[model samples]
Target chain A: MNEPILQVNDLHYYYNDNQAALNGISVSIYPGERIAVIGSNGAGKSTFFLNINGVLSPEHGEIFYHGTKITKKSLPELRKNIGIVFQDADNQIIASSVKAEISFGPMNLKLPREEVSRRVNMAMEYMNITEYGDRPPHYLSGGEKKRVAIADIIAMEPDVIIFDEPTAALDPLNAVMLEEVLEKLSAEQKTLLISTHDVDFAYRWAERVLVFCDGQIIADGTPLSVFQNDEVVKKASLTRPVMLDVYEELVRNGLLADAGVYPRDMREFRELIGK
Target chain B: MSHEHTARSHTGRHHHHKGGHRHDTGGSSIDFYACHSRIRHWNPGFRVGFSIILLLFCILANHPAVSCVIILTAAWITVGMGGLSFRRYFSVLTIPITFILLGSAAVAVDFSRQPIGDFHLYLFWGYLYLTYESLLNTLFLILKVFGAVSAMFIMTLSTPSHELFSVLRKARCPSLIVELMHMIYRYIFILMEVQRNMRISAESRLGFGDFKTSCYSFGQIASNLFIIALKKANAYYDAMEARCYDGTFAFLEEEHQANPKHLIAAGIYLTALMSFWLAIR
Candidate 1:
């Protein structure tokens, strides 16, 4: 709507033997939009994210950031603007110490020492891990490591952040913490694009949903609309969120006169059902 | 949850060791292992200085008594201050002693000329005459190596690896070498774990039926491990790049400080080493 910050056109990718990983996929993301790309395993969701960050190039497609086509020549500049967080926190952390890991991104930009120190402190504070600043990353708890990894990228101040299954290995509590962080990042006007199999996470955090099935986008809309479409959900090999399923079942049984349902959480679902 | 709990326990143990000084306010209840862990308190400059001093001593002095005294002092410091157990101390000396024995055997068999006055038959292998003089010379050689190795280990066991790297960095060690050292240290355990997994997998597959097959399986496992390590390294590098990491390296803090007691002990060790060298000469 307001000068799309990212545009992917006719993207086609493959892993091996020309088996299409992404088939003519097109998506546009604006600044400050929380978009979730949901799909089952081997559905090319991760491949799409990789192509967006220039980590993996599509055989036939064009990716543009701010109307400028991203090329090998401009990848370094593009990457500086788009930070991708890998799923594994262990793989993302490069430095032995927490402080050094956070400072790594700022130092890569070749910022002055004072500015680097300031940004490191700011990023640590943002992640609520100032005390862990002196601790080794390997020694920190998994949640703490994940926070430090996020802080490492946050220090870079990327305009667009990509997370690949951020909550895949996290406990419910840690997953909620991750969602809060993502919400905060989105609030800061950072374009957040996450690829996840967790429908609940997608439904809770994403304003727009992209459902990938057999290396193609079958549905793209608000989370509620996407989940309500049984055909699309079945095709994508995805299940509706529990609350959404319950609401649909209630509507099917003619228990609710109105089918339109929007409940933020389980408690809200109970209240809505009572009404 | 158990894994997380164990990881937390390990972290807690390290933190406890790190914060041991704060609770031990009495100053009399000193734990040498805790003291060794606080080798971070030692000055990087001093570590480098003493390392250079030891290097020079090794090059300039060769007397058996001097080397013996140096070796003995290093062993004492490692055992008393570094908190290395007797078994570990002996284990560290074992390889050098073995090499010395082999060298002495070679000298006895090859050289007919007597280097020292004492000539007693230590071992007789047909025409191979193993003399006591040659044995003593071998022991001296072993002691010299022991002194140098023990000195280096004392520095390492007392000082944290990160501080040791800092000392190396300040000594104008090549950035590439320092980085490689850091990376190797960080990933060696990972590689070892990978190797162990491969071994376990191979064993599980019953690939070790005969000697030849076992060797073949071992080679396959090694090759597979190498490939996996390379893939992991590449993935790790990509992950690092995603986090905006560049070539320059930074550390948490310059933890190594100059403690007066450590310096005094180091000074005493150096003085004793020099006096022994002079006395022997």
Candidate 2:
């Protein structure tokens, strides 16, 4: 409805030495939409993100940013608009220190030093990493590194930020911290795309879900509807979120005879059970 | 426990080089010490300069008495002025001490073709002996090496590697060498962690249940690490490209000007070290 901030049409990509990583997948993303790209390993979710972000150009199809088809000339604009927060913070962080690391993205935009400094300060403050500004980012904890990685992109002020498995290998506390940052980012009205296997996190956090299986997008809809599609979940080799499963079971057993709609999380489930 | 310090990873690549200054034991990193050092804010160029002058002074002076003063004063500055913990300081010296002792032993013991000197202790009919001259030379060499190491200890104990790298970058070291040092310093910690994790993963799978199995697992892990390194290098390049990396890495450096007080301290240290050297010579 908001002119599809980003769109991909029959997008196809392949590894140089391997088969197609993304095949015949298409989707449109809108502003303020929290999208969770869910699938098994090698499900083309990462390839899809890279394609839309212009890191990997599609061979068979095309990606559009703000209604303009992405190409070699439009790539820089597309990349600046659609930032990808890589899964491994160590890989994403190019600068040695946190301050320099955050400044990198903004400086690449070739903004004036004062504006770059402004953005750097704002990003560090936003990510709550001001204390570590002088510290080396490689020395930051997994969660701290993740924050700095996100901060690296946020400093650029991208409209659409994509995270590739933001919580993988992070400890429980760090994972929760990541969720809070995601919540804050979402609240700020920036479009967020995250590719992860954590169905529970997707169920609770994402409004929209896109399921990829074997390089093809099998389902795309609200998390409740898409995850509730047992066939899609089965094909994707993903278990349906427990909350959705329980809600469906209740409706099937006629125990939720008075139920109005499916619940997305524990709090919503409790409210539904109470009703 | 960073002693209420933030739970920093300290496993970063720079930490490997910073910890190199003080630890060959895989012990706790000395970066905490370096970051909190009294001279932490001192210009790295100044610290390096002071340490170099002190080290050369010791080596060129070559007097046991001057070496003693250099060693004692460096230890004092590192511990007192630099705030390096006694525990870490002692641990860091172990490697240097080992090498110096081995070298000194060679100097102390001799196999002569002629009759032994008057000060020599006869062994195997004077063919093998320890002479006073050799012993003196050994002691002097020991002191010289120890004093030189202690000078380095002070510098490494005070300045973190990244800052030192910056100083080197500013001094117009070949960019490629500096970058190589920076990258190698980082990947060492990352690779070491990867190696450690793979070992743990292997153990978890009982891949190392027996000596035969352990050897097999070691072989597998080494090969797997190589593959992982290749994959990681590829991923890192893509990430860098995603961030619009040009050829050079630009940083938002906080300026650190040289301190005159620090300069005065350097002057005083030179005066003290050389005064002892002059008095001894």
Model 1 alpha-carbon drift over 4 Å, by segment: A14-17, A71-73, A96-98, A124-145, A250-259, A270-275, B1-36, B63-126, B158-169, B201-217, B240-272
lDDT of model 1, residue A223: 95
Interface RMSD, all models, one decimal each? 3.1, 4.1
Q: What lDDT tens digits, residue by residue, belong to model 2 across residues A1-275?
A: 56988888998888864788987988888889999999999888888887887777788897888888887987889878778899878787766668877888887787888899999999989888899887755456677888899899999999999999998977898788888889999999999999998999999899999999989989999888887688997899998888877877888889887455778788888877776
**Number of clashing residue pairs, candidate 1:** 2
What is the per-residue lDDT of model 1 for residues B1-281, given as tens digits with 9 covering 90 to 100? Answer: 32254244444544454353332222111121323343434576776577667756865687777766667766776676556665645644565577766765665553333343344343333233555666677667666666676666556555544556667888799988887876765565356546655776788998888999899998998899889888889878877655545566654444446778868987887787788678768
Mind giving the per-residue lDDT tens digits that candidate 1 earns over A1-275? 68899999999998886699999999888999999989889898878877787777789999999999998887777778999888877667766567877877788887888888888889999989998775545456677878888898898899999888888778888888888899799889999989998897788778999999989999999999999899999988898887677766777889876646577577788788787
- The TM-scores, one per candidate, come to 0.79, 0.87
Candidate 2 residue A251 Cα shift, in angstroms, is: 4.3
lDDT of candidate 2 over B1-281, digit per residue (tens): 12112233443423454553332234335655566578677788988888889899889998998888888889998887776666668767886899899978977887776766645455665566677788888988999999999998778878866777788888899888887776776676567667766887899999989999999999999999999999988888778767776666665655689989989988987888777778768
Q: What is the DockQ of each candidate?
A: 0.38, 0.39
lDDT of 2 at B254: 59
Most TM-score-accurate candidate: 2
